[model samples]
Target: MNGVSKVSPGVGTGLSKPVAAALSIVDCDFHPFVPLQEVIARMPARARRSVQVSSYAAVLGREHNRFLIPTGEPLRLDAVPTRGGLAGSDPAFAVADYLDRWGIAAAVMMPIQAMGVIAWAAEEVVNSYLAAMNDLFLEMWHAEDPRFKMLISVSPHDPDAAVREIERLADKPGVVGFQIPMGEIGLGSSAMFKVYAAAAHFGLPLVLHPNSVDCSLQNSPSCAGRVTRSYAEHHVLLSQPGQGAATQLVMSGALERFPTMRVVLAEFGFSWVGPMMWRMDTAWQRGGGADGLLPRPPSEYLLNQLRFTTQPYDEPGNPRDLVPILDSMQAHRTLVFSSDYPHWDTDRPDVVLRRLPVELRERVAKQTAMETFGTRLGL
Candidate 1:
């Protein structure tokens, strides 16, 4: 971060590399939440009173205290701007603190907390809240910065409306992809297939962020069978739903149908990815898909159609242990760096991956993300 030859990428002050030369990143999981007031103001006149902008995940499991997870404010309190805005809600502060400071070439903006409202809000009101939040992000953040890219937040509860929103934003600058909850609905259902079709038509990927509830969801994801008691417990298992989503999407022919679409699993660790792929490939080959639901092995779809972010890198103690797992998962091309910034457990990019050899470092830090995001990042 200091004493290095760093040039400005021409967004904020200048472009610079993240903590170390090897760690210059294309940050894939930067969370920018909309301020509550802005969110409410954008709501339709009739429904604004009933629609709450707070997180609906608070009520998901009556058994566990979800409150303890986020600990402080969801965003880092210190990052809040002096100009009076929420921590992640301010574009200027984000640029000064995150993008320029880290020398990140590009950052994908996933404004996800707003969608957390959909789980408990009135069913009919879900689409409006999402649409308004999408508008708010476009106006407040996307228009304010060149380095920020957009991930349109939409729920699959109303597939037609979701498609309409996707089409509307598809042509807009920086509208790179969609962010949907993995467990909100079954990934391979026909309802979700329509949404995927819209994304494929637009040539945008879907970023599967972790969240397990939705007002209109019908089927339970194979993962998340019960609520856990601690933040650490919940954090450790975030990959379960991600795994379930990948499994459902592959087994049910969603990938087969939407061949051009891509998926990025955000903040979901990679330790389980290798094992999951092996199990699915094994089952698909031996159990038989005579009906042609799965025309090829599950690994083919998983490898070709999906990309994953590397943050909260599963290994905490010994960095050497990660080498074999990364090899098994073919992480050389699949992994991208993410700094779940401004959170208590946020991984410091300089410290986390620098221990790896330079070749692997280049893949995780830059090449894989450039390949996954493509022209959307102007790569």
Candidate 2:
């Protein structure tokens, strides 16, 4: 709040130019950051001292994005106002820059720090800091506009705490989903079932935004033992964890246990869904679909339970080629639009997949998102 000035209409006047040709849109993976300072400010005194006087929550400020060329944090520099402030640190600017400019009907808040906090903090520290950030999100952004729905971030480190967080804020008009931090943990592991159950109980989806965290799960962030050299390689392989998580969740019996559970693979490209689903379906059938577990093939569980964001939608040499890819994933049923706004590589809704058939395009641009998050517009 100290450095983030409210946008003066004339200065930061007018909303951003619309990306896609559409007027009404629902952006699923928007990042709303509470400055690290603000998060520290909200912490209980001991935590506050821990953050300021010592190296507490240091990972939040780490250079996790620079495994490639020295390009800094993924945020767009322009997003940091000419007036001086951290990029994405101001909600008023986001209104002027993303929502108002594009005539966006609704945008989900996936706070970056909210996810990062869980990756490194101790369970107790994670709980207090997360709760504070949730409250901060309500006061700073969600309370400002109903269209900016909040996704409360929960650490898998504490299942009971995660459930409590869900129950505590589920009834809020702006709270719509939960950010399930990407870690060594898989979606189906018994450790995560409680979090999943709690989310299903509230009808809120769990968002798994991939991170370069400590996970021995799949092909490590790098094929060998190192971080890849460029963002291009890392970006291309971003869907691995989503694929792995889906496999684990299905095999672990989490989906069969909580049938209504919904999962959103945030920023995880949609292109992989077709191949992954096919692979799982084939495996499930060969393995008898269930050794006393899953009643349906893995693909059925994935198709019905999971949704993917089209931020880095497949871009073949010809954009039209991406259509077949979307079709394979059942575009209308499984895809949702996510700009990943304010990031340096943020997608422009109008430009990303401007070549799809008119009807199919609209579903990706808005309708699917409406179905995914629509229940909250009135509340």
Tens-digit per-residue lDDT, 1-379, candidate 1: 5788766432334333445643567888887767656666777877677764333332222212242544644555556665755667678888877876776777888765644543443645666677877887888887888678888877656678778889888888888888875554678888887899889888888887764441112122233545444566667777776777778888889999988988888877887888889988778767644335887888888888878888777764877787888887888877788887755567767766675556788888888887777788765
In order, the Cα lDDT scores of the candidates are: 0.71, 0.71
Per-prediction TM-score, please? 0.86, 0.87
What does each candidate score in C-alpha RMSD?
A: 5.2, 5.5
**Candidate 1 Cα RMSD after full superposition onto the native fold (Å):** 5.2
| lDDT of candidate 2 over 1-379, digit per residue (tens) | 7989866554245434465435577888888777667777777877665442222232353334335424755677667754566666677777777777776778888877765543344677777788888988888888777778888888657788889999998888788888867764666778888888888888887777765342212223433335655767667667776777777877777888988877788886888888787887776677743445777777777777788998876668877777778778787788888888887878877765565667676787777766665576442
Deviation in angstroms for 200 in model 1? 0.7
